[model samples]
Each structure stands twice: as C-alpha cells, then as structure tokens.
Target: MKLSLAEQMREMDKKAIEHGIPDIVLMENASIKSFYQILDAYGDVSGSLAVCFVGAGNNGGDALAIARHLYNNYCDVFIYMLVPEEKLNPSPKTNFEIIKNMGIPYKFVENDDDFDIEVINEADLIIDGIFGTGLSRKVEGRFKKAIELINDSDAFVVSVDIPSGIKADSGEVMGIAVEADLTPTFALAKPGHFLYPGRIYAKDVRVVDISTPVSVIEEFDPSFVAIDSSQIKLTYRNPTSHKGDFGHLAVVGGSTGKSGAVIMASKAALKSGVGLVSAVIPASINTAFESHLLEAMSYPVDDNGGFFSENSIDSILEFVADKSAVCLGMGLGVTESTKKVVKAVMGIEKPMIIDADGLNCLSFFVDELKNRKAPTIITPHPKEFSRLCGVKTKEVLEKRLELIKEFATNYNCIVVLKMADTLIASPDGKIYINTTGNVGLATGGSGDVLSGMIGAFLAEGYEPLQAAINGVYLHGLAADIATESSISYESLMPSDVIENINKAILSFFEA
Candidate 1:
C-alpha cells in the first residue's frame, strides 16, 4: 500500500468530510475499530481500567469519542485532557460534551502534577491521543511529561492516528513519543509508522478504514509505496527457453581476505535466475572462488598486491563485453588503485549495481556516475550514504528521503538506501520502502547478496528501477523466510539468506 504524508492524510480526511461523511462518523469508525482491536488483544475490556491521554486537537476528539465507547462497553475509562474543555477544538469539544453528559470520569491535566503516576499504575491500557500527524516541533512541558509516564508504565498502549510526538513524515521522535503496543491508524498508514524510532514507538500498526473513499486517496497519486511481493514483476520462464536466454551477469570485487563477498554475490546471482553468472575477481582468489562457487563461472583479473588495480579495468571490461549486467564493490578494498578500476567501470555503459567498497570509492567520484553510458544502481547503508553526501550520519537519516531523491535524480541513477526500512529511490522521483526482512539481515555480506540479486534482475531484463525494487524486496523476503524456521536473527547469515532465495522467489509467485 502507498503510505501517505501527514498533509496528504489530512487532505484525505477533509475530502471524506466534503463527500458527506461526517467528521464525527469518521471518528466513530476509528474509535470503534480501535475498540475491537483492544478486545482482540485483551480478550475483554469489561471493568478493565483504560487511561486515555487527550490533547486539544482533532486527535483529542478521537480520544473523547473513544472514551464514550469504552464506557459504553463497561470498561472503566479515565479521560485526562491535556487542555481545558473550553480550549478543545470544535470536534473535540463536541465529543467532550457528549462524554461529559455520559458522566465519564475525567480530569484536566494541564500541569506536571496532574500527570498522575497512580492513574497510570492502575490502568490495563493507555490511549495516546496527545498529538497527531501534523506535529512539527519537539514535544515539551506537560505533554513530554505525560509521554514519559506512558513509556514508563507497564500497560498496553494504543495510539490513535499516530503515536503522540512522532513526526509523521520522517518517523523522527519529537523529544518524546508514546511507545504504543498497537496503533490503529485512520485511513492510510503514514511514513512515521514504518520509519525507525517511530517504528519502534508504534510496535504493531493496524490501518483502519475510517470511511475515506478510494477516489479521495487516488487523487493525490502518491508515489511512495511500501514494498510488497505483489509489486515484484517475476518473469516466468518458457519451456523452450535456453540457459543463455536470461542474460549473463558479471560480479566484480573480492580482495585478498574478502573473496567471500564476490563468492556470495555470484552464488546469489545464479540463485536469482540469472542465466549465466561469473565472478571477476583478483586472480589470487581464483582458487577460493573456484572452490566455493560451483554453478558460477570465474574470470581472473590481474591483481596488484592481492587487490584489483588500475590494470584490472581492461580485463573487467573485456570480460563484461557481452554481459548484460555488472555488480561491483563487494569486499574490494578502498585502495586508490581499486578506486581507479571502479571509476573506469562506471563508464562501461552496462547496468551496474555498486555496493560496499564500490559505494565507498564512488563517494569520492560521485559526479562520474552522471557520465556513465548506462544506468547505475547504488546500494548504500546509512553510513555509506552519509559519506557520499558529506553529511553526518544523523543528518543523513533525518533527511534520508530528501537526500536519496536528490542523489538519484541528480545522478540519474537508482539508489537503494539500506536502513531499517530499506528505501529504493528512482531517478523519476518514486520511492519504495521495503517492509520485509528482520534484524537477522544485520550481519555482514548481506549487501553483497542484495547487489548481486539486483544485478541478476537487471541481467534478466527488468528495468533498472524495477531491478532495484525487486532485488531489495526479495533480499529481505529471503531473510524473513530464513528466520521463520528457528534460525534466530543472531545465527542467520548471508549464506542462509542465499539458501532461501528460491523459497523467497517461489513465495513471491505464490503470493
């Protein structure tokens, strides 16, 4: 599903209201769905204490409406309004009046002391409605205190819309944010719900239909998509097709001690259905490559001190002359000579997937990518991207979406920014966030596997953009599948991910 920005969601809400869906009705639907989700989690809410922290905005209105429902369902509901009743927004004020008429227990928590620790201690569930998606600044004062209290509590938290104090666009925490066990968001999920700090805060997010019509959402034509197998374009093989039909991919890199990088990459390419795959590595590692990779062919490049030197570029070009795609930069030491080789390959005019030291070396010659003959795809984790952008890691993360878009658009290439939520930014301004995979993929050599998979897809004739998107989604899906059979995240290695490639591909077709 396409994730909406905060403004896009507000616009969706407005459009729903304009089309005769009452604001109160949307609030009712959201609260009712949340009530059911609570029931699903806790079995029953009758006589169970639920403390709701309400603010002064429309989100507060959601809390007030929900408070009425919880009371009706026989739950002991306690409403803690962050602002006075008179200061509430019109919708919240309306709901406040209704809840007031119902004689629900409520308090105006306008100060630090009003954030009662005892109340939180007695609650089975906490409803966080202190802030909404429009929140821009850092949380402060009484709200921050309340958020701290919520986080410190042992009770299950259900955040309405988004967790309070989470920046909806970037998923950045605003000083403090509620740690929610479940977040029943209205209409569409926001970027914050999936991005880190925010993803951690919103543990289990469930998107509830609040009667917003599909026509309204499609009007925005959201370009941001959450990656899923359905988006992967898997080309079925014809019975008459030969081995050469799928195209050959050249894997380059693997220095003296890092031969395993190219080996993993080459094997992964073969696993990804590349018709012919070869590893172009330093001749010194030929024995290592030959021993580990039985299905893939190997091309030995002249090695200078056990690493590809400037002289290796000629051998690489000649070797890849007939190859459809090239993957460079796994385990290639960031030596000056190796950088020369990488820079030379950039001008070869083939679909190239660059990673690890390839990305590190390219960081020095980023402008060279624009002059390349064919499309380029770069896979960079946050630290590598930060080095390429010449920004601090935190700054790179804070502006990930912006930086990746700028880099891809400016260089006219595709970027797969590896993060907790892997984002594929295309030159055409489209962004895809990968939702599969787990912490199990946090080990080394995973990026090499990803680059190889992407190269294989490109070799198999997927567009540069689709190749990157498919490769990232499949890479994560493989790890996810690998971990499902008792292979803990700590024990799951990149080779394990490679082992599950076929299963992941078959699952894609099955899905």
Candidate 2:
C-alpha cells in the first residue's frame, strides 16, 4: 500500500476538499470509521466509560464527533478538551457545538493540575485525538502530561491518524507519545505508523477510508510503499522446468574462522530455489565449506595465510564469471588484499549484493559504486552504512530515509538499510519499508542469509527492486514462522531462519 508523509497527506486532504468533499463530511467519515474500529476492538461500548482527549484541530474534531456516536450508543462519554471551545479550529468548533448541544459532560483543562487522573484511570477506553500527523515539534505542557497519563492507565487506547507526539515523517518520538492499542488512520498509512518507535506505539493500524477521491491520490503519486505478501510478484514455475531453469548464484566470502557465514549463505541461496549455488572461499576455509555445504560447489582460492589475499582475485573472478548473480561479503575479513578483490569484482557486469565485511571494504572506495552500470545492492546496517556514507552511526539512524535515498540516487544503486524496520531505497527514489520479521532476526549471520535470498531472486530474473523487496519480506517472514513454531526469540539463529525459508515462501503463495 502507498505510504504518505504528513505533508503529502495534507495535500491530499486539500485536493480532496477542493474536489467537493467538505471538511465536516471528512471528519464525520473519519469518526464513524474509527468508531467501528473501536467496536471491533472493544466489543460492546454501550455502558462503557470512554474519555476523549480532544484538542483544537481536526483530529480533535474527529474525537468530538466520535463522542456523539458513543453517546448515541449509550456510552458514558466525557470529553477532556485540551483547549477552550473557542480555541477549536473551524470544523472542530462545529463538532464541539454539536457535542455541547447533546449535553455530553466535558471539562476544559489548561494544565496537568486540572486533569482528573483518578477518573482517567477508572475509564474503560481512552480516545487519543490531541495531535495528528501535522505534529512536528516536541509535545509539552498539558499535552505531554495527558499522554503520560494515558500511557500510565490500563485502559484500552485508540489513537486517531497517528499516536500523539510522533513525528509523522520520521517516527521520532517528541518528548513522549501515546501508547495506543489501536490506530485508525485515514486514506493512507503514514511513515510514523511503520517506522521504529512509532510502530511500537501504533500497535495495530487500521486504515480508514474518509472519501478522498482516487484521482486526488493518484495525482500525488506517493513513492513510499509498505511491502507485504500482496506486493510480492513471483513467477510460477513451469511444469516441465528443470533445475537449470531456476538460476545459478555465487556466494563469495569466507575466511578461516568465519566460514560458517558463507556456509549459511550458500545454503540459504539453495533453499531459496536457485538452480545451483557455489561458495567461493579462501583455500584455508575450503575444508569447512566442503564439510558443511553438501549441495553447493566450492571454489577454493589461494589465501595469504588464512585470509583472502590478492592472489585469490583472478581465481575468484573466473569462478563467478558464469554465475547469474553474486552475493558478496559475509565474514570476509577487511584487509588490503580483500579490498583489492572487492574493488575488482565491482567491475563485473552482473547484479551484486554487498553485505558484512564487503561493505567495510567498499567504505574505502564508495565512489567506485558510481562507476558501475550493473545493478548493485548494498545491504548495510547502521554502523556499516555510516562507514559507507562517512557519517556517525547516530546520524544514520536519525536521517536514514534521506541519507539512503540520496546515496542510492547518487550511486545509481539499490540500498537496503537494515534495522528493526528495514528500508529499501531504489535509484529512482522509490522507498519500500519492510513490515515483516521480528526481534529474533537480531542474531548474527542473519544478513548473510538475507543477501543470499536476494541473490537467488536476482538470478531468477526478478527486477532488482522486487528481488530486494521479496528477499527482505521472506527473510523476516521466515524468522517469524520460526518463532511462532516454538522457537524462542533469544535462541533463533540464522540457520533456523534459513530452514524456514521454504515455509515462508509457501505461506506467501497460500496468502
């Protein structure tokens, strides 16, 4: 589904209003849809006490209208107006008048001291509508206090649009944010709902249709997308197709002690349904690959002692010459010789997935990426990406979307920034946010498995962007399946994730 930024959503709303949908109608639609979501989550609300934390903006207007619906259904609804009724926005003022005329109980509070914490604690439900996607600054004063109170309460909370205090575009929590059990967003999901801390707060997001014209949404043409099984486009295998019809993939990276990295990667590629898989490793680690990888072919290159050296460059290039794609740099040590080999491989005219130590090596000559015409995908976690971009790790986390997009555009490559919520940026400026996977993927060698999965897809002739998206989604889905099948998160290893890849793919098709 298309994901909108705060500004884009506002523009959509503006265009929608200009297209004949009045602001009040939009508010009413949002309230009614949100009410239904509440009903689904909370069941019967006829005799329930619901505290609506109403602000002065359109978001608050949505809460005010919802209050009327609650009242109509026999809910003991009370409105806690953060701002005076006179201070409400035009549409919100209209809603306030309606609720006031209906004789609903309400209180205007100017500060934390005026709030009835005991009453809020006793309520069964809290409707958080104090802030919307337009919020960009830190929430303070009564708003902050209100959020703290709501979070402290045990009541089921529903936030309108997005949880209050989250920066709509970045998901950065400003001061504190409301911890809602459910979030009912309008039209499109926002970045804040899928990105980190905000995703944690937006536990369950239900997109509500507020009658925005399809033409208006199409005119905006949002570039951000949330990847799910529906977005996956996998070709059906022909009935008579042989193993060779799939594709050959080369897994290139392995040192003395880190041979398991390449082993897992090669196995993952095979599990992903590649026609053939090969591990190009140092001579010192050839025995480990030979023993661990029974199906994958291993090409042993001369090593300088136990690590990759310049002597292996020629042999490495020759072995990967016929491969469809290259999955590079898992456990490949960062040394001058390894750097030479990595730089040489960049000249090859094939799709490449660079990860782990491969990223460390590329950090030295990132400009080399700009010289390549082939599809190059760099999978880097925060620290690795920081090295490639010559920025601090904190900065990479803070401005990941902008930095990844700029880097991909400048280098003419695809970037998969790995985090709790992975982000895939294409050279054309489109960004895909992956919503699968769980904390179990935090283990070591997980990225190597992901690189191999992506390489297999690329070898199978999937577009570079789709290959990356599918690989990421399936990688996470596999981990999720593993954890659900009784594997504890703390004990979930990359090998376990690899073992579940088939199940993940089956689940995708079944869905």
Best prediction by lDDT = 2
Clashes of each: 0, 0
Would you list the C-alpha lDDT of every candidate in the order shown? 0.88, 0.92
Q: Model 1: residues >4 Å from true position, as ranges?
A: none
Which stretches of candidate 2 lie above 4 Å from their native place? none
Tens digit of per-residue lDDT, candidate 1, span 1-511: 7789988888888889999998888888888888788788766888889999999888889988877888898999998989887788888888989988889988888689987799898899889989998899999999999999998999988898899989998889989899989888888888888877788888778888878987887776675787766688898889999988998999989999999999999989999999999888999999999998899999998999999978878878888878898899999999999999988887787889999999899999888888987988999999999988899999987789999999999989898999879998988887888888899898898988998999999999999888988899889999999999979999999999999999999985675
**TM-score for all predictions?**
0.95, 0.99
**What TM-score does structure 1 among the candidates reach?**
0.95
Clashing pairs in 2: none
